[model samples]
Target: MLRTMPLTKNLTLEQINHLIDTGHAFISPFGLNRTAYIVINHKPFMVVVTDVSINAIQLSGSWYNWDELEKMGGVFESEFEALKAVAGGA
Candidate 1:
């Protein structure tokens, strides 16, 4: 079970915090699943889970650019499962 979520300008910070606090995780094109927090400009950000929450935040370029992160987007289908397997082995 994988799901793709886009962080749009409509989603607010509070709504995103609530979703992670509740248990549903989001998958980015970069393939970071179960990502509770995201670091943008050295600042930590929470993830959004609801449709309404998805419409509350103003997105900035620093958050959207994953190219700076090493090996950020190579993973594709089953990435989450592979990550989980690695975590479990560790």
Candidate 2:
């Protein structure tokens, strides 16, 4: 059976990694050289893993590149942290 991730709170870094490593995260092509792994939560936030290198959390609207997002304090140490930072607009 497929394991369902809980959406009550932000996922941990380990959990995000597991989702990517186990091919459970949704995969989407970003560009010719990049791929995105997306994890959606019940809340208004979503965590996106880019080519296994960077993690970006999108609360809503369009996506932005790492450089542009970093300027807005959107960059984080991990997917979990990114999600936590954006949770409830914190």
Candidate 3:
């Protein structure tokens, strides 16, 4: 959608790399579903499949602001789904 300077610190570079290196080990519960961190066009996003909401899977991502990382983030559904759109044919 729109990219802006992030005003939140939901995730860090180390954490992001960790997520990439380790698949859902931190957030994985019961091994039913896992969370992932993906970067698109210089932005980072967290993807997870949850039944708590009607939409099921949700995404929280954005252009992180190193100075003040507590804002400017948005929600995304799935990385695969998002990438599909980015690939120019969703």
In candidate 2, position 62 carries an lDDT of: 48
How well is each residue in 1-90 modelled by candidate 1, as lDDT tens digits? 867566677878887888778866454343333233333343334443212122131122223323432123211234354344334431
lDDT comparison, 1 vs 3, better candidate: 3
lDDT of 2 by residue, 7-78 (tens): 435888898889779977764323222222232332223333333223433322345665556455554444
Model 2: pairs clashing at backbone N, Cα or C within 3 Å: none
- Which stretches of model 2 miss by more than 4 angstroms? 1-9, 27-90
Shift in Å, residue 71, candidate 1: 19
lDDT of each candidate versus the true structure: 0.39, 0.46, 0.41
Worst 10 residues of 1 by lDDT: 49-58
Q: Estimate each model's TM-score.
A: 0.24, 0.23, 0.23
49, model 3: CA deviation in Å?
A: 2.5
Better model by TM-score: candidate 1 vs candidate 3: 1
